[model samples]
Target: MTQNKLEKYARLLVKTGINIQKGQTLVINSPIETAEFARMIAEHAYDVGAREVVMRWSDELSTKMKYLHADDEVFDEFPDWAKEFSLSYSRKGAAFLSISASDPELMKDVDPNRMARQQKVASSALKEYRERMMSNKNTWCIASVPTAAWAKKVFPDVSEDEAVERLWDAIFKAIRVDKENPVAAWEEHKRNLKNSMEFLNNHNLKSLQFRNDLGTDLEVELPEGYLFVGGSEFTPKDSEFPETEFIANMPTEEVFSMPKKTGVNGIVYSSKPLNYRGTLIDQFSLTFKNGEVVDYSAEIGYESLKSLIETDEGSRYLGEVALVPYDSPISKSGVLFYNTLYDENASCHLAIGKAYPVCIKGGENMTSEELEQHGVNESITHVDFMFGTKDLQITGVTHDGEEIVIFKDGNFAY
Candidate 1:
């Protein structure tokens, strides 16, 4: 890409994606492999008159090594400064940019359960931080950086540079950078998705269904006036304003919402593997009753998954249940995006971690304790796994036994 093109991408991140206002602090979470792009972001943020640009980088290999060797005590002890930093950031208006594209498989050797538990404990230390991030509401956007591992996953036969090029092309296409007017394209896209949401809201359907050859018979109840949110940008911090980012549209074609915390039932087969805390749970199946996961099986990482479900009372219940038909842009590209930023957007999925306050009616203002009472799952982790398949069919039903087709053959119907 030319410098101008690169600059355009950066500008898009600011003007279009995050829509950074003057004097906003930009916190960018990136990997060292993407330091070049991070620097470009700093420059672009400054160009857009940002107050400050804070960049944090993580070495995936080093983190994995730590997980392999760290003592149990290390898992329980979180740095006070880290907690303070989280709280401080939450108190202010800030913009967050997450650049992934790291090797999702990098943490494969680390114990997933241990890592998951450690994260939960660590976040517990930063309770205020968590609250502020969620309740205060911040503006944030997630993008990715193509690393050697991600590149290798995409193109096993190609060299690293070639793989990176291909990955970049995909990113460009997924974000609509190839469009003559990318921002305009995103605006139109968001408008289209909003129309879908409006339709679902008008239906006022009570429950949603998913059926497929894999025996997915699940029902997710919707609280009254529950909004279907997609294709929008959000504030990462307290003071930052909101802008629409990437239309929140993934390559997948599922319009999703959070089911009533106490309403999910039936069994779901994860058509896609779940990589959590460096562990990949392949061929996973979970059974839910009364909104709690009662049964689960996986070809691999079963122990880790078991640990996840047992984390907290709300862990067994879901926070966000999303549907993505196989027709997603990522799926259409026929790429197994190891990164969840793309992968989660690629397929219909469910999260077992913290519930989005926005997902529940009047949830944004609810106290954590109150939310718990409502059966809203709360955890530091929000891991998503795919459940949508080609033969899957979904029907939305109301309390009166009215049924409306939502998805069929891995695509949205009506």
Candidate 2:
């Protein structure tokens, strides 16, 4: 990438992704592959009056090896300092920008059981940070950078250079970096998302039913006081950094809320391969009974799927329900990006574990015990997978027993 374009992307990220407030510290969690880009971002952050910019490097090869070699006991031990390292930032009202560029198949050979165990430990250790991130208590955004391996996964026919550039082009366009004014474009996109959320929230849906010939027959019951949300809003009543509403993801497209913990039923097969902690699970189908995955089968990485479900009791149920049209910009590209950040935006999906409190009305004020009392699902992880397609259909079941088509053949019916 050219220096000028790099500078431009950095400015957009600093301004729109996390919406940095003056004097706020920005912590960037990125891969070494994105070192140059991270430096540019740090410079931009300083230029924008940011108090500090902490850059953290996460190399994929080393991460993969940790899973490859670590024994089961290692998963149970999490450093207290590591927990305090991030929680301290939350205490200081800091902002975060995380970059994801891992290969779609990076953990293909790793032990899923070990990875799942490791995840549980980390999740427990970082509980506070995760809660803050989920509640929008800290300004945070997740952006994507493409690697050669990921590029090839999207375009196998092209040379590594061409593949990288091609994937960059797609990402740039999807993220609005190609727009004449990226920040301005993002403002409008965020507005559209909030509007969509408002519309859905006003619908008073009781339950949602999804169906397709590919064999997705499921219904998600909405919580009584659920509120659909898109983008992110910092409440003056909630935190110190409350001046602006920031978008959590640069290219967010889904209007999502929560699913009542015991309300989901039936089976929904994935329309795209799911990249879970680096492992890919494809050709999988899940059968849920009373919001628990009673049975599941996957042509690939079956053990990984099992490990994921067994991560905790809450992992057996769903935490979120999101809606995205079939004809979305990412879907229209006709290319499977193979990364959840991009792929999840291409279809309607549901997350398993740890529901975002903000997705429910008055949820942010609820204590952990209160949230659980209200049927909120809690666990060490939240994973999303695409299931929406052009042939997919969904009907919203009202409290009155009348059914309305919320999604027909992939587009919003309302």
Candidate 3:
């Protein structure tokens, strides 16, 4: 990829992804491996009127080293400074932008339970930060970067440099970074997604039944007043950042909303491998009863899968259900990026734990207990696993018991 094209891509992210506003502080959470690109983004953020740009550097190797060497006490510790630092950023109205690009097998041998425990502690420390995000009170965006290790995972047959370029090109297309007018294209794309979400919300869908030959025949319930969000967080009612809209995830495709915590049933299989706690969980099927994952099996990462379901009481139930067509750009590319940011956008999926407050009517203002009473889950984690395929179908049942096929053969039906 040429430097000019790369810079243009960076500019697209700064201008259209999070839409950095004048005098706003833009925080970039990225790995040290992508320092150069991160710096480029920082420059572009400033050029777009950002008051300050903060670069938070992290690396998988360091984290893996910690998991391999840190003592048990590290798993339970939640430093006050760590909590305050993030809180300070949110408190200051900083616009956050995180980068994801790590080798899928980075934590191939790490202990899943240990990682879960450590993450739980960290999640607890930043619970308020999460609250701000879920409420859409703070703006944030997540975009992918191309790293040698990540490129190697996506393209095993090519030289590392070639793999990187190929992956970059694919990502550019997926995010519309290569559009003749990227900003305008994204505006149109976001409008289309919003229109889709509007249709779902207006349908008053009570439940969704999914079926596939992979033994997936699950039914998920959606509470009244549920909302679907995708592409951007700018609902008609949102008055935040009116000048520049908020895009939560770059390359976002799925129109997602909260599923009633106790309203899911049946068995469903995962369509793609999920990289969790540094472990790759693939070929998994979960059985649900009353919205809780009662049983699960995986070709690999059984322990990791267990850690996820058993993380907390809320973890056992469904939190978010998302719909993405089988023929989405990311899906048709025929590459498994092995990263959730890309993979989840390629297919239909669901998240366990921590429902977004934006997904329910007045959810953004409700307390955890209040949300729970409405069947919206509350937990410290949210993990998404894909399950869309060529033969997958989803049917929506209205409150009046009228049944309508929402998805047929993995494509949305009008």
Candidate 4:
């Protein structure tokens, strides 16, 4: 892409995505390989009159080596400045760009248990950050860059350059860069998702049923007064941030949520494989009863799944519940993007870890003691996996005994 074109896309993110205000801070976390695009973004953000632009770069190999060779104390101690910096971002309200394109197997050689612990620490940091954001109302965004490692994951046999180009094309299309005006395109796109939210809100369903060729027969209850939020919210960053501009779904193959901290039941299967800690869990299935995972099966990576479930008391419970239709932009691409960032957006799925407070009414300030009293589960992890496809069906049951067909064969049925 030309510099001008790159700038145009960056401007799209700054103006429409992050809605960069004249004096707001913009943070770009990019890989070293994508410095070119990152610089373009920084310049574009400045052009939109941003007060400051910060950049962070990470090397996958170095990160892996540190975990493999560093002293155990290193994992226990985060730099005070780093923690302070993260807290400051929430306090001041900055827009963040987290570019993830590394291979899922970047740390495959490391010990699995050690890797899980490292993940626990990272997740704990994020949990604190999320809490701060909710309390302070900060806006942030996460996107990916196509790098050599990421390309290898998509097309193992292809040259890195070829993979990068192909992945870039996919991203451009997914974000709707092919449109005449991508910014205008997203504006219109978000409005459509908002309509779906309205539809769900009006349906007033109590339980959702999903039936698909994958042999899925699952029913999940809806929490009372669950608000449907498409893209956007009132936050301290420019209210116009593209991150906020999105409906909760993206390239969205699914519209989903965590089962009522106490209402998930029945059986469901993963339509696609899940990459957990550099291992693949293929042909996975889980049986739930009254919001708890009772029985589960996987053709691969059972140990990782077990480790995840055993991580905390609430790990066995569901965290995120989502809806992904078959006709999502990623699904329409007709490519099995193995990465969860894209794959999860390509199918309806649920998570097995920490549930989002925002997803439930009166969840944010609710303490763990209070939540447990209410029979809602909480955890430090919130991993999502896909299970719904175009061949699947979802039925919504309302409090009034109305069974509404929300999805048929993977597309929204009005």
Candidate 5:
């Protein structure tokens, strides 16, 4: 990619993605492979009067090695220091920017149970920090950059350099960084998404029925006071930032809300492969009865899928339901990214485990028990899997039992 475009992308992330304010500290969790791009973001953050920019670098290769050779007991424990590191910065009102660009199959050969154990332990340790982010108590954004292995997986026929170039072009277009004014472009995009959110919320939908030729015939119930949110999110009025708005996910195209903990039933199929911590799970189908997965099967990476579902009791239930069109920019690109960050935006998807507290009315201030009382599910994990097809149809049922077509042939019907 050209330096001009890279600089523009970096600036858009700083100014629009997180909307960093003057004198606010910024924390970046990024892969070491993208140090150059991360540094560019830091430079832009400093230019906008940031107080301090903290870097937390990760090496997926090293992590893979550790998973391969580390003791079994190691995965069962989470260090208190690591937990403190996250809590301290989060308490100080730091804005967070995470770069998601790991290789799609780095852990394919490794045992999925080990990674699952470590995930459970770390998530338990960082529950407070995770809750803060989920409730929009802190400003946070997740974006991606091109990595060699990721690029190669997305475009296997091309040389590494050519693959990376192609990936960069696609990323720029998806996030609107290719436009002359990316920030303004995002504003217009936000308005478009807001229209969708408003339409869903105004409908007072009590349930949604999904059907497709893939044999998916599922019904998901929405909580009584659920809310649909898309494009941009705001820190709660009583949060440390107090109504400061930020984009949580760059290149986002879905409007999402929480599903009732025990209000889902029927079967759903996967439309694309799911890359779960570097392991690919493809051709999977899940059968749910009263919001719990009763049976699931995967043609590939069945063990990984099993480990994910068996993580905790809450993992067997649905947490989030998101709507995306099959004709979206990311979907139209015709690339199977193998990355949930991109693939989830290309189709309608659902997440298992922890529900965002902000998805319900007065949720940000609700206690854990109170959230549960309102049918919000809570867990240590949140994994999204895509299940949208071109011919899929969605019907919304109002509280008064009126059926309205929300989606027809995989696009919004309004």
Candidate 6:
């Protein structure tokens, strides 16, 4: 991609992705492979009057090496300084931007148990930071730029350079950065998503029934006062910038909400591969009873899937339910990025683990006990897996006992 195009992409992330405010601290978490793009984002942020910019760089290969060679006990502990690093910035009202571009199978050979242990430890230590983000206490966004390994994974048949170029093209188009006015394009896209959010919120939906030829036959109940959120999200009234509005995920096409902690039942099958912590889990099916995963099986990465479900007590339960049309832009591209940040936007999906508190009415201020009373699931981890397909159908049950077709043949009905 040309430098001009790259700069444009970076500008969109700063101006619209997190909507950086003047004199506000900005924090960026990025992969080392995308250092140039990350630097571009930082420069753009500073140009927009940011008070300070903090860059946290990570390397997937190094992470994998640690998981493989580090002492087993190392995975069981999270450093206090690491926890403080995130907390200090978040508490000081930092707007976070994360670049997501990792090789999907980088950790395929590592022990799933080691990764699982480390995940649990980190989640526990950073619970406060995680909660803040989930409630929009901090304005944050997750976007992506193509990395050589990721690009090659997405287009293995092509040369590395060609693959990277192809991935960049796909990313630009998906995020609308290829448009003449990318920011304006997003504004229009937001308006379109708002329509769906309004439709779902207007109906007092009690539950949703999902079915498809993939053998998915599931009924998921919505928690009381649950809200379908899409497009831009606003920081809570008590947040550092109460009026700040940000898009949490770039190229997002799903309207999502929390599911009742103990109200999901039946079976659902995966429609696409899930890239979890550099591992790919594919061709999986989950059996839910009372919102908990009673049984699951995967043809690939079974151990990794097992580790994910067993992460914590709450990991066995469903926390979020999201809807994405099969006809969406990312879906139309016909490219499976194998990255959740992109793949989840291409399909109707559900998360296993913690629910977003902001998805419930007045949830941002709710106490843990109060949130539990509202049937919100809580956990250290949240993982989304795709299950949407062209043949899928969804029906919503209203409080008045009326059955309404929310989705027909993988797209919104009405």
Q: Which ten-residue region of model 3 has the weakest summed lDDT? A: 234-243
TM-score to native of every candidate shown: 0.92, 0.97, 0.97, 0.90, 0.99, 0.99
Model 3 TM: 0.97
Candidate lDDT (C-alpha), each:
0.73, 0.86, 0.88, 0.71, 0.94, 0.94
Better of 1 and 2 by TM-score: 2
Clashes of 2: 0
Which lDDT tens digits does candidate 6 get at residues 64-158?
Answer: 89999998899999999999999999998999999999999999999999989899899999999999999999999999989999999999999
- Candidate 1 residue lDDT tens string, 10-98: 77777766666788888888889889988998898899888999888888888887888988778777888777765676567676677
How far residue 151's Cα lies from its native spot in candidate 2, in Å, is 1.3
Clash counts for all predictions: 15, 0, 0, 24, 0, 0
Instruction: Give per-residue CA lDDT, model 4, range 229-288, as digits (tens).
Output: 545444524333323432222334344444677788888898887777666677888888
Report the lDDT of model 5 for residue 213: 99
Off by over 4 Å in 5: none
lDDT for residue 279 in candidate 3, whole number 0-100: 76
lDDT by residue (tens digit), candidate 2, 95-202: 999998888888888877777777888998898899988888888889888788889988999899999889888988888888778888877887877877877778
Estimate, for each residue in 84-172, the C-alpha lDDT of model 3 and write its tens digit: 87889887778889998888888988888778898789988898998887787778888998999989988999999999999999998
Stretches off by above 4 angstroms in model 2 are 70-72
After superposition on all CA atoms, how large is the RMSD of candidate 4? 2.9
Residues 279-361, candidate 5: write the lDDT tens digits: 99999999999999999999998999999999999999999999999889999999888889999999999998999988899
> Which residue pairs collide, candidate 5?
none
Return the lDDT, model 1, position 400. Answer: 78
Q: Kindly indicate the candidate among 2 and 3 with the higher lDDT.
A: 3
Q: For each candidate, C-alpha RMSD in Å?
A: 2.5, 1.4, 1.6, 2.9, 0.7, 0.7
